[model samples]
Target: MANEILVLGATGKTGKRVAERLQKKGIPVRAGSRQGNPPFDWEKAENWATVLSGIKKVYITYYPDFVVPGALEKIQQFVDAAKNTGVQQLVFLSGRGEKEAEEAEKIVINSGLHWTIVRSSWFMQNFSEFFFLDNILAGYFVVPKPKALEPFVDLDDLADVVVEALTDDKHNRKIYELTGPELLSFKDTTSIISEAINSPIVYEEVDMDAYVNTLRDYQIPEDIIGLMQYLFTEVLDGRNESIKNDIEDVLGRKSTSFREYVVKATQTGVWNIQNGQR
Candidate 1:
């Protein structure tokens, strides 16, 4: 029997790619977004019951992140509802080095639904598809952590691992710490970006307070600024430097590197749009 999978955050970075990959593989995917029929909104309860009507499995990617406000409460509520609605499996996309995220994982694990957790490192796409894009386009990549090294994982690998967990039962109850094959400093990561795009992109390091101030000046939400500060100071401080073999363990191949991500994204013209040359 083909399972119906509900994908929360269906329009976001990893969720979109996972949904597309599933569809291409002919998996039945119900895109759970505010725009879809029987829309799914994390903040709205009425929409939840409708979206999980026939969903036997769920790929849970919390928007913004899993550590944000009321996320644990919301996740608990969703799990209870999913159990009542008879959801058989649950896959959560989580962040590494987050205690709150770990707590949320525990909630889902004990939710009476089969569960798997993908604890991810910083995404390689952040430079090209996320907050750093504007900075890169403007010819500089400024960051809060000057000395932090990240094994930035590729979203393609993440999507693949997610699809495997959703479709196959072997991955049930396992926690996968997913990271890239090489550890690179923010400066080194940006250097790859420069080489891939054939342009010189500079990396500038600033203190967390300064970065937070800049975010405030830009009118970024206080909650988001807090999270970014936490991630940089608390999570990125030499804790995730060692490269892991989890990708090979899960997907039977070497994980994608920073350079690979830059090259592929550049070829896709995403960087061109960022450079304002489009």
Candidate 2:
């Protein structure tokens, strides 16, 4: 019998791709989103049962992530509920080299269900799809200039791995640290962006305090600012400044390179949108 998969955060970066890939292969999928049928909201735990009634597996990509405060308790609640409700498997999207994320991983490990963890590096799409996009279009990309190197991973490869994990039993009880083939500094990544967009996108490094103040000035929520601070201060502090072969080992292929991701993003034309400043 085939499992009915519930993809939490189904509209998110990784979850959307995973959902699409599963549906393409004709897997039974119930998209778990606030807008989905029998809506699933992390903050609203009351909605869990309606969404999980017939689901057997889950692709859980926590919003913002499990590192944020209150997330651990939420994970514990969700895991206990899933285990009791008879969900058979779980695939958790996790961050690489984060202690709090490690703690979150443990909840799944001890949940007494089949589980796989995708511990990922910084995403290449952050420049186009996330925090840096608006600034990139404006030609001035600003962030804390961490000296750490990052093997930025492609969401495509991540989706592939996630699909395999959800569908095939080979990946159960394993943790895959997914990353791109090469490590790149923020400067180097922006250089690729410059070439791809054929524009003068510059990378400017600022101090941590300035970055936080800027976020506050934008009236961004305190919780979001907290995640950003944790990422720049703790996760990006040269601790994960190396590459791993886990993606290739599991997929039986080499990981995507930063240049290839840049080329593809440029082809999509989303990265080249111009603002008046640019």
Candidate 3:
């Protein structure tokens, strides 16, 4: 029987791309989602065994955020289940400068499963696909992060590295710290967006409380708001300034630049389509 790989959070930003890339390489892939057949749900332990059946490898991406409450325990439980189910390898999509995420990575490392940790900084897609999209379309981006300079990693690059780790044994037992080539503050990031979209876009640095209130006004859940606060206040406190060469080491090339990301995202009609920007 051919080895089957399970991709957790299959519909998410990175997971979607990883599934596509793996399928393009003609590898068997099982989309592990609540909606998929033999569905997998992180909150539902009953579905785990069935979804893990016949899966030799896994690309684990926890939804919302990995640093949220109950993530570490859930990850440890999943790791145990995967190992017991005869899974041979695992690749986790993790965040940079997240102590909780690092602890979760440690669980995977000690799981006795061949593991590769893709610790990524802020995603470049955050502007094009996630929270920042609405702000970009609104002609102004607001956030609490002002001085933080993040080397926003490209989702494409992250997905490619994940595919590599799944198909090749060379990446086993390694932690890949992925990020873009250049550091850019929120102000600089807005400038890049303006340049790419050929329009004037502004960035406003509000206090952390104001940002939280804005999210509250939008009816975002409290837990998610807490996660955002933790990221802006704790994780982005100059903890990830140094760039790593993991992209070059794993993919044998330099990581994508933010300028390239802006241009490519523009071409994808990401910024061009202003409707439902979120």
**lDDT tens readout by residue for model 1, 1-278:** 35768988889999899999989988878888988777889889767888898789999988666667788888899989888888999999988878888999999989878999999999989887876776677677777865568889999999999999998999999999999988888888878787877877777788888888877866778877888888887888777777788889999999998888887888878777445532
Candidate 2 C-alpha lDDT tens digits along 142-231? 788686989999999999999999989999999999989998888898888888787888678899899888778756788878988889
Give me the runs in candidate 1 sitting further than 4 Å from their true place. 216-221, 273-278
**C-alpha root-mean-square deviation, candidate 2:** 1.6
lDDT of each: 0.85, 0.87, 0.87
lDDT of 3 by residue, 4-96 (tens): 789998888998999999889888789999888888899998779889988899999987787677888889999999998899999998888
Clashing pairs in 1: none
- TM-score, cand. 3: 0.95
lDDT of 3 at 95: 85
Error of 1 at 124 (Å): 0.4
Error of 2 at 252 (Å): 1.6
Per-candidate TM vs. native?
A: 0.94, 0.95, 0.95
Deviation in angstroms for 98 in model 3? 1.1
